[model samples]
Target: MDASSATAGRTGRATDAASRRRPLIDLADRRALLACRPDDAEVTEAGRRLKEAALLDFGIKESVVAAWLYAKCHYQIPTTAVETAAVVAGGDGTCLLLYNPGFFTEIGLGGVRFVLFHEARHLIHRHLYAEPELRADPVFTLAAEVAINHVATQRLGQGLPTREVPDGRGGVTTERVGIDPREIHRSYRADLREQGLEPLGYDDFVLTDLTIYGELRRMRNPPVPPPQLCVHLAPDGEGPALDDETVGRVVEDALTETMRAALRSGGLARDEMLGLADRSESGGERLGRMWGRLGLAALRGETQKTRRVEWWKRWLSDTLASKLREGERLVYPKKQGAVLLALGHEPMLSRRGPERTKVVVVALDTSGSMPDRVVDWLTTLVGRTDGVESHWLSFDGAVMPFVPGERVAGGGGTNFGHVVDYVEGRLEVDGKRFEETADAVIMVTDGYAPAVTPQRPDRWIWLITDGGDDWPERHDPPMACHRVTTGDS
Candidate 1:
C-alpha cells in the first residue's frame, strides 16, 4: 500500500478507537454527574435574589421573562462529553439545562445568568426546530452563536465570561468563552482592508437569524469554529430529538409569557418581545397565529408588520374579546346596603358581571372547496375555549345543523344568506328553534355567493376562503371579515 493509504488506515482505526473510548452515559455515570452538579440551593438562592432585586428595582419585561424561562428549564448533569452547558429537549414539553458544575464555578453568577438567559432565548427563537438548511451549515451555527451571545451581552450589559475554554489543541486555556462574532469581524476587516467592504455594525450584524447568516456568508472565508464551540450546536448542530407536540407546548408557554410581559411592561421588554414575534418563521404558521390569538395589536410602541395567520382568525379573536369582555350581570343588593351602613359615607351600589357562556354559531361552508384542516382547527379552537357553547352549521346552498364525524352532502352553489336568516330567527332548520341569541356568529365560506346583511352586524365574522371573492372588503358597510388559510397558502 502507498504511504497515504497506510496513513488513512491508521487514522480510521484511531477514530474508531476514540469513538469506542468515549463512555455513553447511563445510571452508573448519573451519580458522578450529580456529584459535579452545581449546588442546587446556592443556584436557587442566587436566582431568588436576582428575581427579588429585579422586582424591587426598575424591573423590565425581558428580565421578568428571563426569570420565568430559567424557572421552566429543568437542570440536569452535563454529561462527560459536554464541555460547559447546553439546552436540550427534556422530552416532556420543556427544555433541559445540563451544566458542568466546575464550569459554573469558573463563570460565577454573572455567567450562570448569561448561560441561563441564553438558553431561554433559544426557546423563544424556537431553535430546536431551526431551519434544516441552516442547521446543516457550520456558518449558520456560528451565526446563531453570534446572534444569541450579542443579545445576551447587550441586554444583560455584560461581556462574555473570561474563563477556561477549549484551545482545540486537546488542552484547556484560560480565556474568554467560545468563538465570538466581534473577533471574527475584526479578522474580516483586516482581510478585506482597502477592498471597500464595510463591516456592518454589531447590532446590525445580529439583527435577525437570517441577517447574521446572510452577512457572514459574504465573507471570503467565514470563521467556522471547532466542533466543541457550542454544546447545543456541537456534533453538526442537528435539532433536538423531540416530537412536534412536545416542542409546541414549550414554545407556546414561552411566547405566551413574552406577550404578557410586553403588555404589562413596555420599553426594552416590549422591544425584545416585538423582536421575537417579528423574527418567528412561518412554515406551519403557529408563531404568527399565536401572536394573533394573543391580540398583539394591544401592544403599543413599534408595530410588527404583516401576519402569516388567517385574517379572519385575528378579527374573530379581537371581536370575540370585545363582545365577551362584559358578561352576565348579577346584582348584589345586600352587600351594597351593608357597605353604606358600615361607613358614614353613602355608597352607590353596582352589580357585578360574572362571565357567562358565550353562545357562538360556527357555520362551515362544506362546499366543493372547504378545507378539512381549517374546519378541524376551527372546531378544536372553539371546543377548547372556556364558557363557550358552539352551534355547528354546515351549508352549501341550504343550511343544516351538522354534527362532527357525520357526512354532509354539498353540490349546488353557495348561499351565505341562509346563515344570516337562521341567526336572525327568520328561519328554522329540522324543527330546531333559532331563538337562542348568539353572542357571536362565525361563517367560514368560499364567498362565491351574494352577501346578505346580518341582524347583528357587529357580532358577525366572515372568513372567506382562498380564491374566494372577499365581498365583505368591498361591501358598503363592512362587517368583521377575513380570509382563512388551509396551511396551503
Candidate 2:
C-alpha cells in the first residue's frame, strides 16, 4: 500500500473513541506509568506497529546501524508514560525505548520512522559529546534537533511528519506533525540579519552538530525555542531523568556490538560503520575519542590523532582488563546460590576469586626506537592495577629483565622471537628460569623484527608504535595488534 493509504488505515483504527480516551500522564510520573502495561488493545497494537515499522521498514532497508541498535535494545515499550518518545537506561544495564502509543498513532508510520531515527541519533549524540555544560545549553539542544532532522530527511526522504486533517469543506489537507528544520533555519537567518550579524548559508549552517550549535550561539535572539517534543531535552524535573554513566555504558555496549556485527557481515553495514568512524574523526575531539575507544578507526585503516594520550591508554587498559579477566565467571551471592540449588539449578559465581592474582608479561622493544613516554605510561598503568603480577622485559635481539623507569642500554637489532621464547619459558633471562604461565603477554614495539607466534598466540597482545609495521596482524594465525599513535608524528 501507498504511504497515505497505509497511514489512513492505521489512523482509522487508532483514533477510535476508546483509544482517544487514554489519559496523558505527567512526565514526572513516567517511571510509574511505564512500569505498567497498556490496557487498551488499540494502544498496544499501535505501539507494535510503530516498532515494526521502525525496525523492519526503516531500520533494515534504510539504516543498518539503526537495525543493530534497536535490536540491541530489545525493549521498545508502548505506554502513556512519555509525552513523546525517549531512550532511557534500564536497571539491568540496558536501554529501553519508551513511546506514547497515542502519539505514535497520531504520527503514523512515516512519522514513526522519523521519530525513532531521531531518538537513536540522540543516544549517539549523548554518547559522543557528553559534556554536561554542552547538554545544559538550550541552543545546543536546538542545534542537535536540527542536525538529527537534517540527516533523517536526507536518509529517510521525509522532511517532516504529516497527517491528513479535515478542512471546513470536508476535504482532507496535510498538516505537519513535528518541527521543520528549514523553517527554524529561516528564522535563525532572519534573526541574525535583523541584529546586523552575519548568518551562515544553509549548507554551512547544518554542516555538523557542533557547527549548528556554534552558529546558534551567536544569535542575539534565537528564533526557535528549545524542542518540546523531545523527552530527553526536557529539563531536570520536567521529564524522566537518566543517569549519565548508565546511559553511556548502555550506548557504548550497543555501538560496540553493532560494530562487531557489521565487521562480521562485511557489506553495506560495514561500510556504514566505517563511514560513521570517518565522520567521528572530523566531527570533534570527543567524538573521535569515542570511536577510538571502540577501535573502529583501526578497522578503517585510519590512525586516530593523539590530541590526548588518554584515549589509547584507556583502550589499552580496557583490553588488558578483558585479557586479565579471562576464564572468570560471574558469582552470585551465597543466599542466591543456595536458593537456586534448592530449586534444582546450578548457582552462578563470581569470575575472579578474592586471592587470585593474574600474571602478565610486558615486553618492550628498546632498540632506540620505542618512545620513553610510552614506557612511562605503561609503568604507571601496570603499577596501579590491583591483583596483577607484571614481568617487564627490555629486548633488543636478546631479552633482559628490567624495572620500569630504569635506564636500559640496548643498540642491537630487534628479535621478537627472543621475547616470545623468554615469555614461554624457553630463553632464560639473566640465568633465571621463568616458570609462571602468564595470563597475558603484551609486546610494545615498532614491529620491526620478524613475527613469531607464541605457544599460546591468543594470550599475546601487540602494540605497534608510530610508523611501525603491523606484520603480526597479517601472520598465518593473526594476533591481536593495535597501533599506538602518540600524535608526535
Candidate 3:
C-alpha cells in the first residue's frame, strides 16, 4: 500500500465514469523510539489500545487486527530494523504483521488505526500477489500507494500523520512521515508548469492503479519515496507474504463484515461503499462479483445520464438473463410412489419437479480480426450469467484455456477445428479432456475460417460478425448461426 514513487509508465481503462482504488501511506519517524524496547510499558499500552481501537471503531477485532506486535511478529533482529508496520510472509505462505512497536506507539491511536486498516486493505486488494509486470513498474507501485492513502485519509478523516521530531540543534518540530498524495501532485504540477505542460488534478492523478505512474513520468524529477515509510515496498516489492488463497478469503470475509457494520450504522462509509458499485469499471466489476457471492442488492436507486451504448451488450444481457429463468412445469404434488399408488388403482405413472443448470463453453476466434467489443460482451455475458458454469477459450491455430483477467494474445491465424476437436472429445491435451462435451458451445468469430463438424450440432451457436464468412449457415448440418451486429448505436 505505502510505496515510494519512482517514475515509470502503466495504465488501465478510464471507465466512462470514475476510478479504481488501492491502500497505504507512510508517516515520518518520531524520536519516541529512543524509549521503545521489548520490555517498554509504552509498547504494551500501545498494543492494547490498537486492539481496543479496532473493536470500538470498526469492529475489526480478529487476527492481526487485534493482535499486539509481538503476538504476530518478531521485533528488529540485530540485522534488521522494520521502520514502520509491514505484512511479511512465512515459508508456509501465511501473513504476519511486522511492526516496529516503537514507531506504532509514537503514531498514537488515530495514526496507528489508520496504518493498521491500511495494511489490512493491502491484503484484501491482493497487492502481495500482483502480476510480475505490475510489480516491476515503480510508478504503478507509487500510484497504488497514492490511491490507497488518499482513500485512507478521506475515510479516516485525519489530515495526515505528523510526528514531532527532534531537530539537530536540540529543538523539536513537526515533520510529516510519508508523502501526501496532494503534496506530491502539487510538486508534479509545479514542475509541469515550468515545462509548459498541464497538470492533472489529484482525482485524475490517482485514477487507477497505473495512472499515477504515467502522470509522474511526465514530471521532470518526480519525487522519490522516503525509506522511513512503507518498508514492505523495497525491491522484492510486496512479496507473497501468505498463502494467497486462504488469506485472501479471510480478508474478504472480514471486509464483508466491516461493510455490513458500516452499512447498518448508515454513514458516509456506507454511501462510499455503495457508490463504488456505480463508478469505475474495476470497482463496479468487483462490486458485482461480490454482490453475486454475497447477494447484496445494489440495484439502481436513481437514474443517471445516458452514455454511448453497445448493441451486443443489450443482446447478451437479455439472452443470458432469459437462459437463467425457469419456465412452468407439471409435477406430482405428493411423493412419486404415493402419486403412483393413488393412480395405480389405475396403474398410472407419477410426476416430477424441474431444476435446471447447464454447462456452457465460450470460444473466441481471436485472430487479428477479433474485436474488443465482442470479447467484452461475451465475458460479461457468460461470466455473470446465473445457473451456468462457463469455460472460456481463445484459439487461433492452437487450443488454449483462457484465464480470466488476462489478455488473449492472438496470432494472425484462425482454426475452428481445434475448438470442435476438443468439444467433440476427438482431442485430448496434457492427458486431460480439453472439454466435457458441454451442453452448449458458443463460438464468436468473423467466420472466415473453414467449417468444422461438432459432435452436437444442435447445441452449437455460431455468432458471425459483419463482413465475415457465414459458411455455418449453409453447412450440411447447420447450427444456429446468427449475425452479431456489433455497432455503437
Candidate 4:
C-alpha cells in the first residue's frame, strides 16, 4: 500500500506523536518515485518532493514537523472521493474532510504548503483558544497567511508536475482547479472571526506587518526616554517635500499639540494681538486661521520672505520653548502633591471615622536598572499624603519593608510579580478586596519583569515605563500609565 493509504484508517491522539518520526512516505518507495519522470507511479512522489522543497525554501521546514506531529497526534481519514477541497478545521475543535485531489494539483504544491503554514501560524499564536480577541489580532493572521501563500507559490511552481492527469484517474484534470486567492482570503478572515480575532481589512495587510516589525525592534532594545508625544502623520501629503525644514515642522507641530493638551498653559502668546481667550478650546480650523494671521503678522514685520514668513520655523521654536518650560512640571496633579489636600477634604472621607481610613501600599521596584528619578517620585507619591497610613515595600527579586519616607533600597533586578503577590497577600490579610484595602498600588520600575497578575485593583498605576512586556496571552490588568522622563531624577 502507498504511504498515504497505509495510515488512512488511523485517528486521534494515540497515533499522532508517532507519525512525526518518518517522512510522508516510506523511504524506499519515495526514492523509486522521485527517481522517475512524472508518471502514474510517480504522482505521489512528485507531490512529496514538491512539499519538501516548498518547506525548505519558505523557512518553515518545521511545518513538515508540525504536520507530522499533527497527523500522529490526531485522527486521519481517506478523502480520495472528494473533488475540490483539502482540510478545514475551525477553532472550536470541529474539522472538515475533503477528497479534492485538486487540493494538491489545482492550487499547486506551493499553495498547499502555504495553507498548512497559514493554519499552523494560527495555532502557534493560540488564536483558536482566544475567540474574543481573534478579530483584534488580524495583523498576525493576515501577515501569516501572506507569508504562507508566498511560500506555497514559490515551491509548488518549481516542484509540482505540470502534466495532465488521465480522465478516469482520481486527479483534477481541469486547468483552473485551485482555490481562488480571493476566496482563500475571505475564508482566512472568516476563520479569524470564528476564533474571535477581528479580521484585519486589506489595508492592514501592509499596516500590520509594519507595526509588528517596529514593535519587535523596540522590544529588543527598548526605547530610551519615554515618548512625549505620539504623532501619526498622513503619508499621502506632499507636505513641504520632507526636507529638514519639513521634518522639523512636523516634530514641532507634534510637540505643540502634546504640550497644548497635556502641559499646563502658560506661554508667550503669538504677537501682542489681543484675541478672545475663550475658555472652550477652539477647533483646529480656527487655530489654523489664527496661525495664518500670526504668520502674516510676522511677514508684515519684515518684507523679506526668509525673515518674515518662516512659518514652520517660527511655529516650531515658540511651541518647543513653551513645552520645554511646561515639561519641568509633572503632568499628573496627584503626582505633584496637589491631590493629597483635596482627598483629605472630600466629604465621604471627612465624615468617616479615622478608624475606617484606607491603607495605601506603595511598592517600589528598586532594581539596579531602574532610573533614579523613579525612586524619587515613588518616594514622594507614597510619602506626601496623611489622613491614611501607608506602607512601603521595596523589592528587587523579593519583598521587604522600606523606610516610609526614605529612598533607601533600589538598584537591583526587578521582579514585578513579587509586588503583585505581596499586594495580594496584604489585601487577603486585611479582609478587604484590592479596591477597598488600598487607595492605590503605585509601582515604579522600567517594566523589565516577568509576567505578573495582581488581584483586582481599584486603581493601579504604572509610573516607570512608556512600554514593555505584553504576554502570557491574557490575565492582563487594566493599567493606568504615566510616562516618566529619565531627566526627572
**Global lDDT scores for all candidate models:** 0.58, 0.67, 0.54, 0.37
TM-score of 3: 0.46
Top candidate on TM-score is 2
Encode model 4's per-residue lDDT on 362-451: one tens digit a residue. Answer: 666666345555455444533543344567777787676667546565555777776776676642323433333555566656666776
Better structure of 1 and 3 per TM-score: 1
Models 1 onward score TM values of 0.50, 0.58, 0.46, 0.28
Comparison by lDDT, 3 against 4, better one: 3
The residue-by-residue lDDT of candidate 2 on 1-489, one tens digit each, is 002111223445433232233345543344665665555666668667776877797455677767766776656676655555677664456667777666667677888888888877777777777888888877887888788888788778877777665554867677665556788788889889989988989988877777788888887876554435466556665555456776677667767756654543446566667755643466667776667656675556555563332335544555665665445512234586558546754333323555556787888888857667777767656644555677998889888888887888786899988887878788777788789998888888888887798888877888877778878778879877766754453
* Clash number by candidate, in order: 0, 5, 8, 23
Which regions of candidate 1 deviate over 4 angstroms? 1-23, 26-62, 74-81, 92-94, 127-129, 164-174, 191-198, 237-245, 278-290, 301-489
Model 3 agreement with the true structure over 1-489: per-residue lDDT tens digits: 232211110111111101222122211112222232334454545555653565356432322322322233332221012445555544443345545444554556676667665666465445323465755566665666666677667666775665454455877566566658898889989999999999988888776544676788888887777543575456663332444554555555554443433333335434554433322225445444564333234122222232232323333333333333234211222354345435532111111225444567888877745567667656655655444567888888877777666788887678899888887777775676854547567888888888888767766777777666767868979765655655543
The local lDDT score (0 to 100) that residue 200 gets in candidate 3 is 88
Q: Report RMSD (Å) for each prediction in the order shown.
A: 20.0, 11.6, 22.8, 22.6
Query: How would you order the candidates by lDDT, starting with the best?
Result: 2, 1, 3, 4
Q: Give me the candidate number with maximum lDDT.
A: 2
